[model samples]
Target chain A: MHRIALQTLLFHRAKVAAALAGVAFATALMIIQIGLYEGLRSRASVLVNRLGGDLWIMAAGTSMVDDSELLATGAELPARAHPCVTSVRPAIVAWVPYRTPAGARHTLQLVGSDLRTAGPTHAYVPWSFAEGLPQDLLAQDRVAIDDGDLSRLGLAPPLVGSTLEIAERRVEVRGVTTGIRNVSLIPMVFADVETARTLAGAAPDGATYWLVDLADGSCGPSVARAIERDPRLDVMTREELASVTEEHVVTESGAGAALAFVALLGLVVGTVIVGQTLLSLVREHHKELGMLRAVGASRSELAQFVAWLSAFVAAMGGALGVILALLVQSGLGGRSVELHYGPGAILTGLAAVLVMCTVAGAASLASVLRLDVVKVLQ
Target chain B: MTDERGASANVLEARGVVFTHGTPPLETRVLHGVDLDIAPGELTVLMGPSGSGKTTLISILAGLLRPTRGRVVLGGSEISAMDDAEVTAVRRRTLGFVFQAFHLFPALTATDNVAEVLALSGTPIRVAREKARALLTRFGLEARLDHRPGELSAGQRQRVAIARAIVTSPRLVIADEPTVALDGPTAASVMELLREYVSAGTSVVLVTHDVRLVRASDRVVALEDGRVAYDGRGLAANPHGAPSGHDIHPPTPRSSEPVAGPEGA
Candidate 1:
């Protein structure tokens, strides 16, 4: 029985490939489309990872430091008194597009960090070194530029020692960085709190948020309540902040909902294409099915054959689709657009592809339901 | 051979079967009324030219087509009144049909095609494959077991079809021009394979335009138009069992003009 299932699918290997190709196109399109959305969200709040803080304390209702603002609040003081406060850093965002000394130009987000534990905040752009020398980015007038931004600025990649013009002020590119793409969607240059405040022309003591890094024993929920209890400010964890960003886009910017609708469209088109392709294959083999039936195969066995074939095709198509999306990732180079792919999305895409295949298989599956040996023999 | 597998006589009894095709202007009744009774284990040959209603009669006998009005009983089951699906179920376990074209599935190997019916029939995979291989080997096709129909000669493919038809051990086998696709030797070989089932008491109903099989068949039924022109014992036209009415040419060659396409009849 298993061999028959294998042989039946391979018997029309071409048709199976066609069906899978249809499904693969859909799965790939949806996955990559979502990848872009995720990439955009990551870029919008990348400062979270670098902030070295498990908890972000900010003025009431402060949504983002780069684009969001809040009135002066007591978000900084009490967070420092907690036993979990290994360290706290004042961080602000200053995004300004500037040309390089090498006659190239692009935008970079300038993030400030506390003189202490600043590496976790902005220094992560160069990538946090678990085993290498950490870039000391909080040096007075020194900043760190990402490898991607360095290349874009007409400078050689890994540009460890270079100069960046911080709005008519000279700031040395002290260290080259990595991982800037995951969060900023572009490039980032990190400097000390003093330098960032100077560049943005803001008051010296004004930090939009206090990033508090917890000690090893601190419980996330307990610390969250402790921080948010400060009446003067609100606190958001990384995961909470991400969901909020998604909610904001879904409800406010409409990007989240728009993409969801497109993804739904993809499902419809994909299922229709895959469904028709498989159904036609079944129609072509009506005589064969009759022979099988006359031989004594139950309707369920026939349905199994259709489903297995459709699933195999859909899975293959989905994998190829993902590869295709990755191929086009570089095409979005200049648009400050990026794409992210992780195991979670991959597995989800796979599950979705299987579902799509099952839907497509419904058409071919009709043969099992409607076949009558008497008609086929005629 | 009168073997144990040869069924006791009286396997099928058909009564007053009236068959029609299509509706409106295209409507046509092919069989006014037909009746037949066959004993188990006997080979029944239905011989006639195109449009003589031979195929239609064969379909009715095997319970593949519905009679516009009539009751056909097979192995004691009144199948004419059954629904299409019920009829197919009855056909699956009780009857088998050998087609003129030897319609073996192109994708499956010879053995798989033979085994496919067994698989569909709810036979265990291991047992079904074993039986399928044994059947193919019995038919002198062991060498071509894994070859697809497209890869086999017409005779070999016909033998595979025969194996597939008989693999389920149905009580009756109805063959419609089963050997037409083969050359003389292969056709004879195919006929011999089908005859082997008679030892198991399985009745064989072979329909053909060929006169070659007329003499060897246990019973011969001549279909003239939609009605049976002749049904006689001992197969041969002669009552003495010697070559009867020996002639170099047919006494009356009915209009040889091709009446419809090959599938039409």
Candidate 2:
């Protein structure tokens, strides 16, 4: 039965190729869409995830890392007073309007932290410099911009010393980083605390968040509770903040829903492609199928043949789709739009293709089972 | 249920078979009360003109269709009363078929096409192919074993179909116009192979309109206007034995012609 099924499918090479192309396209589309969604979620909680902190102290009701409100002056004091706290550093996350040297206007997500005092795991300041050192941001009126932001910010080859204005305060680009990104799709600017505060119109002592390092092996939840004594602030462990931020991006932002719909659309498109191919294949071979039935091929046998055909197409198409998705990810390497086709997303795509093929096979089996053996033989 | 001489058991017995198409006032009656018996170890040629229901009768005999009224017994089993699945099982185990168009699965090699029937009947693929290979080699298709139907000539394709039919060594072989598309020598060769099956005691029922093929048959049953017009041997078995410009049975009225119902049903 499998031999017949495979041979029959291969006999209609052009049609089977069309079905395979459609299946591969849909599978890659779904994988990429899901991957993009995951990339966005990861980007959304970038700061919360990458910062070397056991806990974060944010203004009350701050929903995500990118939308932090300015906390009271010295909000880090309460966290520092905790027995488990080894050090606490002020950090600021603020979005500011910027005018590039070329006079192009854009919004910039400014991140300010004292990277010198923070632990080595802290990436609040640009760790990978494309042109200059991380200490470049320590200079007065200086900010570090990522290589991805260079084209968007209208900064050409000579990135260093190119002056830009943020929130009406002129600043020079001292360093160019590589691969830093934000979900907001805005340029990311890293600077020291005072420069960020001055540009964002915050008081000298005011910070958007307080990054607290704990003594090695200290309980994070206990220390967070200690810092939560200040009613004007919300203290959470890094993991808790990252989770909440991801949830916010998925639920509140609506981007996740849109991406999920696209992923589902890929599935629906795949089903339609497979269904149409199966229908046409059965129709094309109606006389042949009837002859088989007349010659004593049972309905179950015919159904199995159809199933094997579908499985063949799906398995091959699924493997091709995974390869295509991986190629797409590789093609987009270091670009603004990040795609992460993890094992989970790839497996989901494969499973979805199988389901699509099964649905198509069952539909084709209807006509097979209803075949008129006598009429067909004639 | 036996032949005229009651020699051995009859391979098939059709008692008062009737087959109709459609329902009520719009119905088309294709076979009107057909009673036939086929003895083992003989070639019975079923002959009829267009719309005479010869195809319908063979289909009923093969259990591919059920008669409106009557019972068909094949190899001691009453097939007319069996449900589709049961009849199918019986057919798989006891019947072989050679169709007019050669209905070979176009995608499979000659060996695989012949092996398919054996495989369908629960034979392991490897063993089935071995048997198919041996059979096709006997049919002079040894050189064409790996070729698909499209790669073979009509004669070669028909040979493959024959191999597929007899692969299971069925008790009954039903062929419909098996040589209609073949040349003289090829058709003669096909007839010779079918005759071999008969000599082996496998009942062979062949449906054909050609009198040349009928002349070689052991017995011939001719149908006209949904009724049996003649059943005999030799000269009378000739389908065109009637006077020139005259039909054996009265010409059927145009209004009563079967409404193109499902294929041979």
Candidate 3:
């Protein structure tokens, strides 16, 4: 069929392109705006996602990774005894500084784990670079430095033969790996349980928390019941821990509010921009539209033409915005601004399209709807 | 308002028509009970002075305006009391319009501009374009089929407008002051095109104050101060009529040189 919509679109592509560009920018900004919060929250709790444990036993309200100090490590025995709880590990986590042989100091999330029961907690850590596992880490003063920490140590990347001084103790950097990092942009340092305890001068009787893992599906309630039998323990499954983490990011930190503000600003700015551009174009074409109506084009046909133009531009802007975001964010500060595409991003973008395009179209319609076809018959 | 039954083979007929402009309190009534009939296969010129309601009368005859009191019938349908939708349907199905300033779409191809009416009425694009091309060819505009309005000459643009109007094969073509900008010869050729449409059996109701146009007109209705002051088939008025304020409300002749080129040799 002859497409009045397509004809009009071709006629107005320049104005449409300009309008769509605004939406594209808004899309990019909205993504990046939300990304800032995601980025910061990821920084605040990198250990949650990366922590290999299937369940976390922390203080009742402590969800943030850096919220608590070492309690009693023996807290795991109660949860481990549950029929649903197959394994548990005692893990030590702290923020500390280390000086490499190159003499540069960098902060690290120093984690200590027992080599034997480490499957529940330590599996997520990058530990292959370490010369050995949790062989009394606080005993011998040996250290496992992440490649990022090693780079900051100015040691020219990881070398098994290097040494470091952490917590006023000299230690060998016997291993190197990736993906282990600290909250607030720090690197990670790994050491054996005993050696880390000795190096940090920690009391062995106290532990960070018991990292628990269940065997299979539907084990959460039974594990919770068994762990609750102990007054000192609070058991949370993986999803629950994630939820708590989300709550921490949303409520406890101001980052969430700021991101929301920026996203809203993006939408408003886009609405203004898209609305202005479309309305101007509509004004320019109002006489022509009047002529068309005078000659027998229906109001529905005109509306369809306009709506299709908007949706095409919006959808194009959406796709272009996503591509541009990825392109620009990848090179930002030599670091990738992470884009997490869940179902929510799609919904958010669609909302942006509807809000932006509809507002723009409505603005244009203010003038367009009055196109005195009667006045224009000549 | 009532249709004039048994009306001659005229494509449009107006009986006792009255028209007014503006809203109440500030409104000015223009036309006062005018009567007219435009026969099929004939070119009729409607000429009048500024504020004389010639454009208003033409607008009513084209089914674009509903007369306040009397009836104007187009394509056998009385239009004075019809709703906007019904009026539009009659115009789309039976009427074509050619204006002084060619209203070719500035962005569309010549062929596409001609084809637009069919598309608005749901004609498939390919066939509509094919018909548009054939119409342009008939008008000797085939070579400029892809040119936009901005690219065409004054005469060519008007030709394109004529092609666009007639491409839909409307039985009635209403033209309003089609030569206010053209030289005498160009205007003459434009009128010749209207005459060609008449020869092809399309009725034309042309509104102009330019007397040069009356030569091609089979019948002429001269309106003055909102009434039909003269109605005949004589071509003997001012051999060169100037622009009416009705179309382009004229200024004080601007050095008496407002007329372009020469009048008829």
Candidate 4:
């Protein structure tokens, strides 16, 4: 029976190929859409993911990092007094409008950390220079721009030393960093606390987020609970803040719903195409199936054969889809848009494709089972 | 007619079989009180005209269809009383079927199609293939073992179908117009193969309108208007044995006359 299933698929190479293509296309579409959604969510929380913090202290009702207002100066004083609080640094996060050399105006997410913070590399704004050393941003009025933002910022490659007017302040691009992008595709600029404040026109003591590092072996949840006791502030652990930010950008902003619809459409289209193709194949072989029945094939045997064929199609199609998705990912590399194909996404896409193929097979099997051997034999 | 070798030797028996078709408002009776007994080592050809219910009776006898009334017994099991699954099991284990269309799985090689039967019966694939190869080799299809049905000649395709049927070593082989699509020489060859199976103690029940098969059969059962017009050894030409005789059972009295029609027409 297994051999029969394989032979049937091979015998109708054209039909099987078409069916597999449909499944592959659908799977690829799903992978791309879901990857885009995940990319968006990742972008929404990229800053939080990079900033190693036990807790983030923000102004009350700050749903996302982008929309957060400046926390009052010395807002970390209360958290710093707690036993679990080891140290706290005022991290300034603000979007500053910049006019490019091409005269195109755009908003850039400016992140400011003290840069001297010790411990893990993520203890401060995590920026890796693509063109120049991290110390380049230490120069007065200098900031680092992501390499991905070169075209958007109207700057050419090796953007180091390029100067732009941000918030009426003259700032030189001292280094080009990579992999620092937000959901808006806006370039992210990293600078010292003084430079960020100057770019955002904030007071010397103002900061948007207080990046809190807890003492070793300290519990973040307990520290966060102690900090949130103050009604003037909202405190969240790093993971909690990342989740909130992602949720704010994805679900609250309607992007999640739209992407979900596209993914569903892909599934429906794939199922219909594959299902119809398989059904047609079965119909074309109706006489043979009838003959099988006449020669003593049970209904279960026929169903199992179809299932095996469907699984084969799905497995092959899923592999093709993954390859195509990787190609798409490679094509989009070095661009402002981010497409993520993590292991989770790949496994999910494969599972969905297998399910779709199984559904198609079962639909075709229903027709096969209903076939009247007596009529078909005639 | 009763089997001279006794009931146990009878591979198939039908008693007072009546089959009908359609809803009550348009009910049509096809077979009326038909009875038959097929014994081992004999080739019985069911002869009838087009619309004479030969196929329906054959289906009932082969356990492919249930008669509206009356029972059919195959190899001591009352198949007509069995459920669909049970009948299917019986067909799979005890019966082999050859059809007019040579319904071989088109995608499978000649050997694979034959091997499918053995595989279904739980034989390991390698052994099944070897058995299938040997059987086809015996049927002079050794060179065409790997050829698909589309690549085979009509006669070779029928031979594959025959091989598929007998691969499981079934007790009875039922054929419906098995040679209708073949040339004279090929048809003769197919019948010769079937005769060989019968010689090995397997019973064969075949349905055909071809008179050429009449001379080769061990017995001939002729049906007309659904009822068995004749049940005996050799071709009788007429139901009553005379070449030009009238109806064997005088027409039923007008008040008791039963209506008859083709089963699938």
All DockQ scores: 0.31, 0.56, 0.38, 0.62
Q: Tens digits of per-residue lDDT for model 4 on B62-160?
A: 788899999899977899999888988888888998999988878999999999888998999899999999999999999999999999999999999
In model 3, where do residues sit more than 4 Å from their true spots? A1-17, A34-46, A99-107, A114-122, A127-140, A149-155, A179-183, A199-201, A215-219, A222-233, A332-336, A342-347, B1-9, B22-24, B234-265
Q: Assess every candidate by TM-score.
A: 0.79, 0.88, 0.85, 0.92
Task: Report fnat, model 2.
Answer: 0.69
lDDT of 3 by residue, A1-378 (tens): 125445665677887777778889888777776666566556555656556577787765566656556665566777767777677766667767767666766666777766554455456443544344444343466667766544566677436656677876778766666544443556667776666566555677555656777787587777777767766667776566666666676556666787788888888888888888767755666666666776677676666556765677688888787777667666664243344444466557667767788887886665665566657655
lDDT of 4 at A58: 94
Candidates in order have lDDT scores of 0.69, 0.82, 0.69, 0.82
Candidate 1 TM-score, C-alpha based: 0.79
Question: lDDT per residue, candidate 1, B34-146, as tens digits?
Answer: 77777777787887678888878877777766889888887667889877667667777888768876767777899888877787777877798899999899888889988
Score chain B of each candidate by TM-score: 0.83, 0.85, 0.83, 0.86
Question: Model 3 Cα displacement at A87 (Å)?
Answer: 1.6
Q: In angstroms, give how far residue A40 of model 4 lies from its true place.
A: 1.7
Which residue pairs of candidate 4 clash?
none
Per-residue C-alpha lDDT of model 2 across residues A1-378, encoded as one tens digit per residue: 788888888899998998898789889988998899889878877777766588888988888888788887877886777787787878889989988777878899998887566445565665677888767777668988888877788778787888888999889889888988988778899888888888777888888988888886467777767768778889878888898888898777898889889888888888888889988888777777776776778898888878888989998899889889999999999988888778889888888898888887777989888887777778
Best by TM-score: 4
